[model samples]
Target: MANDTGREAVKTVPETAGEDQQVQERIRKQIASELNLPQAKVKTTVTLLDEGNTIPFIARYRKEMTGELDENELRSIEERLQYLRSLEDRKKEVLRLIDEQGKLTADLKASIEKAGKLQEVEDLYRPYRQKRKTRASVAKERGLEPLAGWILSQPRRGSVLEEAAKYVNAAKEVPTAEDAVQGAMDILAESIADDPKVRAWVRRHTQDHGIVVTAAKNKEQESVYEMYYEYSEPVKRLPPHRTLAINRGEREDVLKVNLDVPADKIHEFIARQYIRGDSAAKETLQAVIADAYKRLIAPAVEREVRGLLTEQAEEHAIRIFAENLRNLLLQPPVKGKVALGVDPAYRTGCKLAVVDETGKLLEIAVTYPTPPNNKVAEAKAKFRQLIDKYRVELIVIGNGTASRETEQFVADLLKELGRPELQYIIVSEAGASVYSASKLAQGEFPDLDVAERSAISIARRMQDPLAELVKIDPKSIGVGQYQHDVTQKRLEESLGAVVESAVNHVGVDLNTASPSLLGYVAGVNGTIAKNIVAYREENGKFTDRKQLLKVPRLGAKAYEQCVGFLRISGGKNPLDGTPIHPESYGVVDSLFQELRLEREQLGTAQLKARLQEQQPEELAPQLGVGVPTLRDILDSLQRPGRDPREELPPPIFRTDVLKLEDLAPGMELHGTVRNVIDFGAFVDIGIKNDGLVHISQLSDRYVKHPMDVVSVGDTVTVWVLGVDEKKGRVSLTMKKP
Candidate 1:
């Protein structure tokens, strides 16, 4: 029976062994089709996933078994596999519930089995789904169900009134034939509404042709949702951004939203399906159809349509967030430089931190260069002292409050110092405060205040974005659109996957990585990560990857999954720094012998050239490994200890900051993409406010999404389209036109 939750609490029937195999086969086929991968490959990947291998580990180490599916594809397979398994369980439960009712039919069972989505299964079982007291239930209780069935059959010989008259009984509360007919019609109305095929057809028609209309609650009030106040768009054509905007507006009580469905078309379609003849009861049946649609079907269809739209929008938002986070995390680290980090403020004074080439804090200070207390000379003197003392090569300024004034101050200070070689970059200080106040930050810097810790974070982020950014929450990074609006659980999972993928792709330095960074490694949880760090601190730098097995709570399984992604430079084994796993050491040794090279010469240019000359297919036979593995080994040999992010463009550095007023239409400038959303991208062009490049201006041709053209940390050339000085907003266009 249906509970308050509106779902039937069915007793689960365990699937037979054969049924389980069928379910697995069905899932494999679905995943293969969805991912455009071979069925065999999907089967292998699923087996690896079921065996507890992480996506990164499977993608990197088990390429031969899984046909070389990348991390993204493997993630997709995993998500779909989980959904399919849940779908199968629900299908079994639904089938069992229907069978127990003694009402399950061959056609109905077939329909349930063929159902692709949970909604379809629910619709097929809607007739038997227990519900609260309704008009239909009241008619059934009044003994009018027989008359309702007669009316539905629409026999040519009998008069509908005569059949309905026989159902009238005083004891049953049917006082007259008219009352009996009305009661019967109520039951028939609900039956028509409950028909699975009828509901599916109506849902599909409405979703294809319906229009979503939104109007402001108060026309006079201005809001961020003003554009959606009088909007009407086809449901099929509505973009994810507009749907999310409309949903947000409705949630905020600023807009009234409704669906404009084709009621007349829906009525005609139902008539053709349920109406059997031009009998005397045709008018009565037509009235019942209208009632059923308006009272039962239309409202439910509208809700389903809205839910589908919301699910799509949420998925899109999550995908965008994940992509932006990946790009932001993979931003090229500025290595081998001493930087002075500034956390700008007005009343509190700007907090300063100086770090050497390795991001170790050398000094901390405070200066008032902006607002009520503009101690320009004092700030300049302090900056000169720090730069000279630490031999600082770059200034890393947090793009937060009072950043413009701070930039002006730094530019002036640089001129006085005559440091032409020194440049400054405006790094996104998003979540810097959150990280500063975190317990991890306090543990790292017990003597530093929040602002001082934030200053150090900014400096370190510029030096190594991935290492520092992982310490904070991905949601707080500010690279997403509608992040707070999406399902928090799903958003966190997706973003976490992105972080894991990025960390594994760029193997972590075992000696230097913090627990937060290590926690993202494959097979390493927070506890294990902390234990690894503790062990490292107690034992000094790890001399080999094998030592991870000795760390408490880190056993053979954890070491197997994580060792390949953890790099130990100048370790006992030269191959440890590369992605080559410990199990593959024999293959590497054989390859070195074949090439007449020593293990110490592995990363040399000479060895790389020699490895490049050998074909992977030919070498695989000799190495007794798959061609994919051999190719990967060759790649690692060619570029040992290489950072994948170094291939991307570096962040833009500025000697001077530009004011919003400085921008002119058609003026071209190079900018770094700060954040990308569905509608547009925000580009940092050395200005106080980042400029917006709408999706239309993203390219000379049509753009489907901003991410398709650019990603966070990408450098692109854009021309100023317009500037709003009053609002401190700048419009930019990547296209020449």
Candidate 2:
């Protein structure tokens, strides 16, 4: 029943609280089931997130509240929760808009309310969305809507043309019966095209049956995308990487891509859905159905299909990049070593910086070890003098221009110097240049040149990878597949999360952390991090955790969120240095009283043994804390100021370098995983170019993804599968004979 006023009454959510709660409960249950989490975990986690708790805080400190959900799991719930909530908001808006037009039926409202996917909801609302000067709108303006409806009824009594003749008015642009009939058909075609059920069916059918076909614009052109020059794959079988590759090629005008589907099937489905028995309007309606599918429906569905595929590909690519970045950032730190850093170059001469154990810039030197200036003897004498005088323990080389030659020089020098402890490592200086020219770097070292800053960065990075790497943009770290091809906002958000998780995991040193590392701590933004640094400089070092409150704009709430992750060694309270929150000091004191242990005994071997012997499951109730939290506290007390990265294996430092010509098929060598991608892992085997371990060769067993076998910073033994000296290609395999 249409309202005369052309509007229907709508209930505000405040008036529908009970119904709103029911919808929320459904959303909670759906998210829990979809994520394979306990319903209680979902409920508790959502509540914590809603209260503005950061993921790192919840994941690290509130383990009991979230059932010990890790950062990744918590983030997944957060994403899905946001999507479901946004979907709810969109559903309400759609219902209100449809009601404003007085067309909100019970069935339509129910269908829209029950829709799970955003696409499904959009499909249902497509019919009610206002049109923008379409052929159908033009036909309706010409007053042929009634004739279109009559034609849709498909009555056996009257002819379509005869019925259309009555609406033939020249003033409205309907010149004759044929013109009116054509206009009526246009209206019918658009209506059929907009039907939600028809679009939904066609979308699913095309996705399941369509073929992604691509052909080169110039068949003989040579490019990196040659594999996709003449490619055809079933839509369901296409991988994310290949989809992005073909899309990039098509964008660059190197390829023509199309989604191929059977047009006849769509026309047939439209016929069976909107038409009934053999009747008078069947002839006119049949042509309209074909026109609708061919003109309106097919192109639209193709775009939707392509868009969905692209969205999925981009999401997967971002996830992979995030994972790789996490692994790279968490590479174990090489602590307490005086390092000599070399930013390798030719004509500019290798820029050198010496950093003390505390990462202070000690000295800067430039030596031409590589050609354009073959001052090898002079370079060796200067390096030897520096090493002896400063007692430098490690040589860190940037894996950039002239790196191989630099490595060779350092190797020969170390051999001549006869220092068994002096070894060098090649680190990916991926974003070192970006950091060197950054404002943060400029403020940090005002007098230093960009190359000097880069050398210092490389040195500090090898000593403490997490601390130094956090200073650069995660995207510039370059452990990504098609990173530039995906949406940048999303990529930055994901990589930032990864960096945040890594920073909080290690728990930055309050006095020593740079502004870059401090910025990523939970609840601390860029401005607050800088203010804290400013406060520290004006005052002395923070003696206790409470001093954080004195920093500008760092309120009680921010302190509560960030304090647990900020450790102050040699603070007023010994517990301040541990991971245990100050709020739990009562439980710690009680535990100490029960165990008869002194606070000074923290980090002692006796304390570790005692803490390890006591069962957390048994002591949790007595301690008045949850088991997870109590266990964490015990571990923290046992090793105050613990760095999580300390537990992992350290990077390999080679005393000698190998040449690409030295590699042969079946030769065995160990390498560090520089980057992991969808197709394979790039292994740095002490050569100019890193070698590739293809996904199929990563293991002898069946592997679905390369990440399943290896990750960035992994040290594994790889056998040379082949070597191309002219092309500078080294193909390696993890599988051994």
After TM-score superposition, what is the CA distance of residue 475 in candidate 1 from its true location, in Å?
Answer: 1.0
lDDT of 1 by residue, 1-737 (tens): 00111001111122234566877898789889988899999988877766667788889999999988888888888888878778888988999999999999998889988888999999988999888999989999999988887777776677877877788799989999999999988998899999998999999998899999999999999999888888899999998878888999999999999999978999999999989878667888899999999999999999999999999999999999999999999999999999999999999999999998888989999999999899999988899989888889999999999998999999877777787889998988999999999999999999999999999999999999999999999999999999988889899888888888899999899999998998888888877788888999999999988899899877777788889999999989889899999999999889989989888887788888888899988789988999998899889989999999999988888887687777899999999999999889999999988999999999988887888889999999999999998888999999985
How far out, in Å, is residue 54 in model 2? 0.9
Cα lDDT tens digits for candidate 2, 168-188? 899999989999999888998
Against the true structure, candidate 1 reaches a TM-score of 0.95
C-alpha root-mean-square deviation, each candidate: 4.6, 5.9
User: How big is the positional error of residue 674 in model 1, measured in Å on the Cα after superposition?
Assistant: 0.7
lDDT of each: 0.89, 0.88
